[model samples]
Each structure stands twice: as structure tokens, then as C-alpha cells.
Target: MRNLLVLGLALLLAGPASATEAEAWQALREGRAVLLLRHATAPGTGDPANFQLGDCRTQRNLNQAGREQAQRWGQLLRRQGIEHPRLLSSRWCRAQDTASAMGLGAVEPAPVLDSFFVQPRQGAERTRQLIEQINAQPRGVPLVLVSHQVNITALTGIFPASGEGLVLALPLSQPARVLGRIAPP
Candidate 1:
């Protein structure tokens, strides 16, 4: 099974940037994998100088297109058989907004999913904590984590685009087994 998963990852990495969402669905159907998603397109690059934890006004928020994109992602994910997934998000407004906007169930705040762009040093420890948590989670329904590019990259070594995601197999391997990428809706 591990070998087959590795082969899938190799094929996905070699394929086009247009990630096959079907591949992600197949991985998630096994019930032992999770999706790590980058928040939808927020206009600017990082947060503004006055970024705050719970204030959307103080952060780089999702544009109109991004909002629509999140809605479409919700529809698409539901269409793909992940109805009411256990969705988690970063405490940041943008990440939380993206997860909430998905309408994929309750959005739980996960501090480990917060971006480490400003404080690069915290990436490793936070990623470790996230991995520990994920590995410890009891498998059941589909799991989705809406996070920033920096945090997702730290976990899977893939710099995901806005709204893009990677399906990762669990137990927390050294280099994560990336089942496949789920492109933006």
C-alpha cells in the first residue's frame, strides 16, 4: 500500500500543474488521509503591517473572486463525496474565512495552521505540533485543514497556490506521502 501511494505521488508530481481532484477523492475515501489547503486568493501577499488575530479588517482578506472561489470549492467538494467534512482552519482571519466560506461544516481554529511567514522560525515546531495532532486524530469522516501556503509547505514541501490543496496520507512520515493535489475550483 505504501509503495502504491508513493507511485501515486510520483505520478502526480510528474503530471501537469492542473492537479487531478479525482486523485484527491480517491485518497480521502480510504479514511486515513487528510487535505491540507491553502486559503483562497486574498488580494495582497502577506498580511498588512497591522495584522491581528481575530480581526478581518486588519488582515489581507479574500477578494470577491476569492469568496466565489470558496463557494465553488464547497460545491465541488460536496459533489466529490466529501459532504460535511471535519474542517479546521488557522486562527488568522483569511484562513478562517476561507474555511467558513467553504460551508463544509464547522470551522475549528487550529493554531498550528497559522502562517509562519513573518516568524519563519516557528514553522518547524508548529508543523510538528500539527503533525502530532493529525497523527493522533481518530479516523472517521473526511478531514480538511484550511491553512496558509507557508504552513502547508512546511508539512508537505509543496508550495500550494491559493485554493490549491494536497491530500496527505497519515501516521506522519518524514517526507509526507502526498497522494495528489486538488486544484482550485
Candidate 2:
């Protein structure tokens, strides 16, 4: 298992989508990688002008499709062999909602996963912190970080669509290797 995961991480671009996602799933299931997921289809670009943390009304929230997508993510992951992951989410309402809707387990708010879109200046620092945190995660534990596109892009250089997931190997290096994209289910 370790050898396959290591090989997958080393040559992430060597295979097709299904093979890539399969290896990515193996890494995730074995606690050798993480799923950096963007929040589900919150129908809007950014938050309202008066957006504030901790208040759902102030932010652009998940639409019905987004909610269902999140639920489907839960079902898909469970079916793919991940039942209860250490779910961490940004403080945004949409992110929290996505995490909650997954029904996998409890959701913890990690500041590093917060969106820095409106506050671009914070991206470098937050990304650095997020990388450090991910590096510190126990090697044998699966984790799921629910965040925004900005955060995901900053860490992985992948502009993920809403509800999309990128599987990254554990102990991430300078340039993170995205093992695969976990398409919305």
C-alpha cells in the first residue's frame, strides 16, 4: 500500500483519471493524503459587501444544488471507502454547510482554510500556515479540508470548481503534487 501510494505521489500525471482517482482514494483511505475540497456551488463570486464571519446571512450561502452536491459527496466518499474523515472547514457559511452536509463526522474550523479572496494580502501567510499545518498532520490519518477556490489555488495552484476536490499527498513538499481531482458526485 505504501509503495503504491508513494509511486502514485511521485508520478501523479502518469495515468488516466480513473486510475489517478483510484490511487488518490487509496492514499486518502490509508491516511497518506488529504482531500482539499472547495465549497459547494455557492451561487456567487464572493460574499456580500457587508459580509461577516459567523453569520450565515451576511455571506453568500449554498444553494439547493450546492446542498445536494455536498450530500452526494458524503455518499460518494462513503461508497468509495471513506466513512469518517477528520473534516476541517473554513469559517465561511458555505464551507461549514458543505462540511455538515457531508454527514461524515464533526467539522472543525481551521483558520488556515479561510478564504483570502477578498483579502488577497493574507494569501501568502495563510497558505504558508496551511502548508505547515498539513505537513504536521499525522502520517497515518485521513483529512478533508473544506475551503474556497482562493485557498485551494494558493496551496495547490489549481483553480478548483465549486465542490471539486484535489487529492494531495501527505507531508506536502514545496510544490504540492495533486494526485487527482475528485469530481463532484
Give the poorly placed runs of model 2, Cα more than 4 Å off: 1-17
lDDT string for model 1 (1-185, tens) is: 99999999988887764455456576685567898889998988888898887788888998888888888888988887888888988998878888988888889999878889999999888888998998888786788989998888887788888999888887766468887787898
RMSD of 2: 6.9
Query: What TM-score should be assigned to candidate 1?
Result: 0.86
List model 2 lDDT by residue over 1-185, tens digit each: 99999998877756576686788999999989998899999998999999989789899999999999999999988998889899999999999999999999999999889999998999889888998998887777679989999988888888899999988987776568888887777
TM-score, per-candidate, Cα-based: 0.86, 0.89
Error of 1 at 16 (Å): 13
* Model 1 residue 77 distance off true place after TM-score fit, in angstroms: 0.9
Residue 87, candidate 1: C-alpha displacement in angstroms: 0.6
Cα-based lDDT at residue 51, candidate 1: 88
lDDT of each: 0.84, 0.90
